[model samples]
Target: MHSTRPFLRDLSDSRRKGWEDGLRDGYAEGYFRGQAKVIVERTKTSFPVRKIKVLYVSSGKGFPYSPIDEAIVETLKTLTASVITAETKEPIQKLAEKNRPDLVLALDGMDRPVEQIDAVRALGIKTAIWLTDDPYYTDMTKKIAPHYDYVFTLERNCIEVYRGLGCRNVYYLPFAAYVSHYRPTLTRSAINRKISFIGSAYWNRVEFLRPIIGGLMEKGLKINGLWWDRLPEYKQYPGGIEIGKWMGPIETSEVYSGTKIVINLHRSPFDETVNNNTAKIGALSPNPRTFEISASGTLQLVDSREDLSSFYKPGVEIETFSNSDELMEKVNYYLSHEKERQQIALRALERTFRDHTYNHRLNQLFGYIFK
Candidate 1:
């Protein structure tokens, strides 16, 4: 025998080790499976089948498109609601009269007529209006919002303003992304841009971007939006740089997917050129782009806002910048650390799909009002 005792001992030890490892791995796999099952059950329970007839009033497609309006309507459809859409005041009345829906929802009601609202309420159906830009259009909104049965506002801080206007059923409804319109890409886009910004060239944005323009361009920066090209101040960029036009929702998602870092500069309601009044300047909540960029599966670098943490965990899910210098510093750092950037982007995308989709928002609305 070739040392039979030693050979037997070695074989026993190896088998013991293998069994322990297998046990550990099997336990982990079983635990994760249980967790996943729980999550699926929770999701199934959250979305109960709800059927209601709704008449939707929107600005419709053209210049200054409202993707959020489209998203809300689409999400309602998934809830088994029969929806009839109207662009303007005239069609809204005609549709409401023909359909006799159980409820009427007017989205972005700054352009809606008070007479039309009265006409819909005359049908003995409940009327609701969701304002995308709350304090920005409060002067007109305060005049009309009190007439509706329910009022939903994107500006959380302005809930009291509607209440002050003697509206009883005001609710805080935040902005969200349409998951289908914005998502991650498996393959990289054909474009070569590294960092991108897509927003209107408001005064604060123009001024904030001026300082870091040269440095960001050296590291590859691309910007696209309305009025960005028309601005003379931004013309000083390097020869290859040019401000591009506004993109549609899907094209905007494509730009975000192609970039490494998507910089989001929120509009100041005080910027009269943009918001017409500075009343809600202190209100610092994120705009729709904040969720859209995260949903696009790109690392988002946004300006510091008070309510950002309620949506994303800064420095973990997304990065925030208070000034141009900080933004430039982070841009360089994140670009060099590819693994960390990708991890954050992945986490953000997961969060967006789990909590910030339009489907989730619509469910919240229905749960609150319908209950």
Candidate 2:
């Protein structure tokens, strides 16, 4: 037989390249269109608009991509403000001089050279850095926090950290899902035996989920995602499916709609630390997966967190599990109780639409910034 292995590998590589190229092109074009739309809208408005031009900076290589960027761009467009993206702070500083935006929104911390931070600050433009990861690890606030006018954190836990650094304003802002992009399409045939989990394969997650993987297979549940490839426990579940890597918004929603149960696992890196140092450093920063999964209207079995309650009512808006036994039990219960499952999904959808959206977040952040 002809060797199809190399051919398949080459085809996969070509497809991935095509996808990346398409994303870059689409982003540039969409960004320009979005900016134009904002300018037009702003021109027609009579409201006393603040002379606020915003620049959003990103390294553009991270999780929960496009949706967040798209939301920021769309918000800028609606606000009729100038927004620009740069890979480095040097370019951003140059652009700041040219555009003279009122606000600088750094997607990650301003990790560029210290001189760049100094240059931007000298321009008298307000700087706001959005921290999406654990502040304990990166400690961006410690180094650059004092220089910025405001620090935006994805979790409430980081507010104190920023305040401790003498940052004048620290706002607790969680990641939000784009409702139009991430919605329920329950028409997709539910894969009765498939139970999906979508996230990076952190070591702690693998340990916590290993036994549940076996339990799932024994009960005829198929698990999928990047985790399965690295899972030594995978040999036990011979028939389980693995849908490697992360899926985009469209594919993720499809998976949520089609899968019988979707699992949301949070990494407990802070939980395991011996010293109170980490907790004093920062506690629960639930990943964006929580909102994304819940927004998809999938029946989610998420790991418990205090923040979860703040967003959801539990058993009403969504469901939760504390350990492996609880996770497996909830999985089996929801699978059997289709009516209750649908009701919970509906409530979760409503909650996401009302409060947990990008627009809602923007409104809150702007209120604080502009007030």
Candidate 3:
């Protein structure tokens, strides 16, 4: 009788465990399905994506833009029935003549195939250019914008700039993370870094960071980008700056994941020597790095911009600063108050995955084009 009772109890326990496991799996599957349904439903009223064919062109520029163009192409593939890719270095006109796609979409206005874009438009094919580096390179982009059927820019302030140049289809489309690559894929190191900045040392950055360079050196800074040698105090911080090494999206995501705080400072619109913004258009929108840092699950200390709050909740999803003094204080505070910093990072990560990814950005872009 005792042996029989033991077998019955074991059987009952096994059945309960299986039931719980099944319930958890069902919940997860249902949640995923629900999320997918929401995205699909959101686009139900938009244009029929399956009918369009896009010729996605990338300049194949190294560093920042190549990865971005690749991500844009990947998302475009899912949106359209067919996506043919061509490099600006190659003859884009020949591909357009061959494929005769419904629309030809190019990334970055720099190094444009001017004649080819004109040729594609002559073919009665809709042509669009998504300008990643806006306002900064507006000197070149202004000449390139009027040729395309649609002109999209990262800077909100440039919409008027483009429209003023007679490009009627100008739209404000901001940068976003390629979510599959930019995520917290790695665990933080045993010793967290106090701060990190991964971008080129433009004239503005050099001037803005001069005051706090000494403070940053003592706080464990990892600076990697071109032209750091331009900083006046470059020699002071030995072994702190790695000049001319570009961190691709995946590598940057890893750094963002391991670090405690990442600084994202926008380039100076007024610096003519470093930038080609002859028109002096203010770069008010957040750059691509903003979404990348947030999506990578790090507490981002970004500088103030006009459209910043439109994308991220101030002091909730992201932390911001107006100048070097404010940035230094936030860096110190977030470094010591680990729990609060982590909470903001977590919230930003969630917000980024939900709304600030390539998929989200392209959905908006396609809607505008097809509308």
Put down candidate 2 lDDT per residue, 1-371, tens digits, no spaces. Answer: 89645655666777867866777745743443343233323322122334567887764655555467776777665564556666542576898898788787776664555466568989888777776665445444467666677878876777877787788898888887775567665333444334777666667777887776777776666555665666786776666756465667877776775565788888654544422234445556566777777777667888887787888898998888989999998888887776677668766766776777776777677778889
Model 1 lDDT-worst window of ten: 36-45
lDDT of each candidate versus the true structure: 0.77, 0.68, 0.82
Q: After superposing candidate 1 on the true structure, give the runs of residues whose Cα lies further than 4 Å from its correct spot.
A: 1-46, 89-91, 229-233, 238-241, 278-281
Count of clashes in candidate 2 = 1
Give per-residue lDDT, candidate 3, residue 66: 81
- How high is each candidate's TM-score? 0.84, 0.78, 0.84
Q: What is the clash count for each candidate, in the order shown?
A: 1, 1, 0
Per-residue lDDT tens digits for candidate 1, residues 37-87, read 343234332465577888888855444546767787788888745888776
Query: Which residue pairs collide in model 3, if any?
Result: none
**Considering lDDT, which of the candidate structures 1 and 3 is the better prediction for this target?**
3
Question: What's the lDDT for candidate 2?
Answer: 0.68
lDDT of 1: 0.77
Candidate 2 clashing pairs, residues 3+ apart or interchain: 38-77
lDDT of 3 at 79: 74
